[model samples]
Target: MPEIPNEQKKAKMPKSVPFIIGNEAAERFSFYAIRAIMPTFLVAQFFNPAHNPALQSIAEARANELSHLFVFFAYFMPLVGGIVADWFFGKYKVILYVSILYAIGNLVLSLSTHDLSLFSTGLIVIAIAAGGIKSCVSANVGDQFDKSNLELMSKVYGWFYFSINSGSVLSTLLIPIIYKKYGPELAFGIPGILMCLATLIFWLGRHRYVKVPPTGVKKENFMRISLYALKKAFLYAWKKVFFNRQDKTVWETVAEKYSPEAIDGVQAVYRILAVFAFTPIFWALWDQNLSEWVLQATKLDLHIFGYEFLPEQIQTFNPLFLISLIPVFTYGLFPLIEKTGIKVTPLRKIGAGLFLTILSFIIIAFLQEKIDQGGRPTVWWQILAYFILAGAEVLVSITCLEYAYTQSPKSMKSTMTALYLLGISLGNIFTSLVNNSIANNGFFARYTGASYFWLFISILSGFFLLYLLVAKRLPEKSYVE
Candidate 1:
């Protein structure tokens, strides 16, 4: 029994994809437009008092910490978002409602540009809205296609990602220039206006969408069953370890009450979640594009033939590479590889992605050595790393969305997507610990700062090996339809 039909396995993209694509471009523009200038704005505008130097130092460090905290909250909120959408409000209602919150949050940001308290409040509001809508919007995109259209789901997501980069490309590059030119109010205000338009674009297509209402499943049921299964599995394993393995019937009666299909679904959800746990490390590495990479480039050469480039401008190359390379990988390279009689299963691509990430960091490690030794490293090294990291993203990040949507039971699609986001939250937490360790001159920062880069490269390599072992032992059929 194949999960997808063979006849329609080849992609034939749908018509409604454009609406979602357009909406996503606008929404991402809103997101990145503000995010593009946020850290600098926090330090320069929000943290700067009438003209106090000591307060300025504190504000800069606080701004950095707050930025990471904002990201952590944004990812963590998906837990609430997924559950609420899955059990209470449907995806459509939640997306529409939370999008309003998103709009309001941006408006608050625009208004509070000079006021610290209100600006902080605005960011928290945006985090709430971002978390709430994160899982549902991607799930909503999946809902547009049916089982017959499953093959095209991957293709559609490719373009969905394409739209994301398209939006981010412009926002990341254009908005910061605005902030530098006009000031914070107009910079934030522009994104707010885009957010309002984003809401309208989504609203306009309300009638054309395929809405998946909540399955009417209670959160209690999932929690209660999860506890039951864990306790039982632990007890049964203990009985086998300390006692005889001959009497399986002792546990049989306890498991008999649940339907076999229900148990299978539960197990599937658990397995998918375990895989998601791998994602945060990937994101911890991926997110550096917006943070560490930009800061680090300021230490390098940005002048090309007398055309001065801002360190922030270095960030634009990510989206440029993303937009250019995604089509090559999705439409050209992957299909060509498939024709060579190789199976590029989702899990395998994930494993491949982790290794590519390791390679990217290894380059960073080498460059860090150059910087530490008072040698000037070329900006090209960072671009090479970006190219490798971008490839890793196509392999891991894009595939995760498609995998999370297709593998989960219809009732739990959003929930599974939220669980995937949990990895990113965890990854940020891990990243903070790493940063703190390096900052405090603690155990992880053994050599120069170069050790920090090597540490992540080593960690990701180990993770990839573990993935291969666990994947080889598991039944592949358990994951797909």
Candidate 2:
């Protein structure tokens, strides 16, 4: 087969690219618009009527918990979503169906602005729709190319990243101002409209896309392979414990009908999951921008040069920083690191991100200490935290998508994406646990928020050091599809 020349790669982007990119930008905007103002909105909507001090305290804490839980469910739904797409619906149909739910969710939020119960119901629906398609959209972008035009994929994914950040930045900046000035109805309604637009754009590209049909429940499903791997692992361990040496032909003993490619894919899945295990903790730290950090900002002075910034608006910096830094790191910083003879593998990049996370928390610890001391610090302190944390996100989140797509077996690509997103869900669970523990024990973050952040710094630092030590030894496994 003749190689496609580099010049041709840029000259002809597939016809479907614009529709996908447009849908992503609109969908992201709709999601972020709601997310940006949720904490402030919750506190405003729920806490204002509480007359009793005890009820007020409960209201305040519940606000944070609800926000965290919403994000938790949003990330968690991808499991069911991914499964349906991989097994029955296919990515295109799943995305189309879910996008309608996404629009209705936004509509409910807007119409139910005054009633918290209705609003919460809308959020639940949105969580299902948004999270369901979350894994499919990027995976759909990957399905658009094969070896003939595969060279364009790298460039395609770069713009995909840009689309995510662009929508995020737009909504993060837009929604807060709209909420403050125009009221909740308009703030929520606009995103509802955008969700409809997202759906429309996705539908427009139906024929242009390179659609992947659902494989249904094959014999070599993830669960079976995982169980097989688990059994093999136990047998190997048993041999090591009793007989001294392990079985060398463990692979051969499995069902011979399973191709080498399938076995290799299963092994790769296990390895990929093991490497990605630490990411939930990473997201746990990152998701705080929407909850705890923003809550902290709400309590402090946000004034700068005769203007004040809302806590919700502070999230705008994440996408702004990402937009600027993703390219810089992609082109300038990563190349420089490679030039210095340091191997910058994906896992190592993730390890570096962990270290950067520690640094950001260290900054948070210091900032929280200032808040504890009754000295209202400038928003710059938290902005500094956002800056460093966004850098870590650039390193980790972008790399994870590439890692998940490339490392997965074709049959299990959506499954891999869901597993990747499940990390964020688990991270949200971790946050909920930490908060619940504090409620019970009254030791962690009871007196000073500084201590809570300091503890996170130590946790990440230990993990970062350990990951760097072990990452180099990870097997570079692959298969012929």
Candidate 3:
């Protein structure tokens, strides 16, 4: 390992830190630029002539469904990207190469705005590229620090997240302006420029990064272990639930061979799997902030200084709120808790975050009730929801990142990051399912719009809380960093 000079060690982070920061900043700008406007753009820019005209009742519904489908696949592609990065290209090279694809995806999106088929293809490509880069960049951040500087890693993550939000703030604020003033062309084109810049910035830091070579055995071992554990756990749980109940003799024999202590390790694996299961519900809510939520905002009364706001501008609140809250929670809230001798574990924070998510939707559901009661809701209601949701994000998202990195086998770090991303991907898929249910069912159907939508989320979140409580008692020491 390379030793840092004493003088340099005590100083602020090196040029590589800023380089990584800059890369992340630009990458986020690109992502949010397209994401902020995607829902609206789907309705306006990529309307299918066969499905009536854009914004017509039927067309609007179809467009929303299609937009969600795009979102689902965009998230799903990270699994493929993570696999490629872990098995073939190293994280650095994979990020660099996929970034180019990212840039191209944006360019294609810009050019294909009016052509539905081409536009959809462009969006798919962009999702693949985005998914590819998402894990790589995050894992790269972990690569920047090691055992000695690991204490500073939290601060580094804070800064990285800060850059992400700063870039998101800019993109959210500007992309809408560009769409309103210039058109979709400029709106999408600017992100391409930023993405190219991000790629260049990452490349510049190549030599400074902690370049861990791919361990050929690790990937194979992970697959074998994960599969074997999953299979055994399912069989054991099944036997306990069914066969053991009917035959006491069989139960005792099985218990003797695979005692509770023997199966504790399998339970731990199941617990981790359980975490992945319920986590997508949260993502369903998170990803929709840019899509369904923006659409809802358009229907609400929004004003600032007597000027009505654009829907896309409302998307800015998430990142803006994140940027402001990060320091407050990290510096102020964390220290206050520490001073009081209250230990804050990631799992506890995640549970609290999950509960907070329930509150966020409850707020939205309440606002929808007001709207349904013939009173137009205030935009401030949406703002409040964003504030609560942002808090949940800080608790769940940040903790998940740190937890995933720490809990992963050292050789499988990038794969773990990909797994975390997969949780979000699955969340989007859940969102799609929800969206599809709403669309296919009548607007007045039991599960349409806010009433049905929020009720479902509340149930899912409640289930997640229950699972967390049950899994909470499992020993986590095996995976702790």
- Please provide, for model 3 over 1-481, each residue's C-alpha lDDT reduced to its tens digit, 9 standing for 90 to 100: 8997664666345446888889999998898788888887776655533535332333444455666666676666777766677667777888888888988888888898788888888888888788777766777787777655667788888899889888888888888988999988888888888988988888888888776555443423445554655565667678878877433343344444454443343334444555656577788777777776777776689897698889889878887788788889899987899799988887777887888788878887787777657677878888998998899999888887777655544544555556677778777776666555555665423554566557657676777767677756744544563
Cα displacement (Å) at residue 439, model 1: 6.2
* Alpha-carbon deviation at 120 in model 1, angstroms: 3.5
Q: How far is candidate 1 from the true structure (C-alpha RMSD, Å)?
A: 5.7
Q: Sort the candidates on lDDT, descending order.
A: 2, 1, 3
In model 2, the clashing pairs are none
Error of 3 at 177 (Å): 1.1
TM accuracy, model 3: 0.80
Model 2's TM-score against the true structure: 0.86
- Residue-level lDDT of model 1, residues 323-417, one tens digit each, is 67778998898899899999878888888989888898888889878986878788889889988888888899888877887776665565676
After superposition of all CA atoms, the RMSD between model 3 and the true structure is 5.4
lDDT for each residue of candidate 2 in 2-86, tens digit (9 for 90 to 100): 9977756555578999999999999999998998888777777865555454443344455666677778888998898877897
Worst 10-residue stretch by lDDT in candidate 2? 51-60
- The estimated TM-scores of all candidates read 0.80, 0.86, 0.80
lDDT for model 3: 0.72
lDDT of 3 at 122: 86
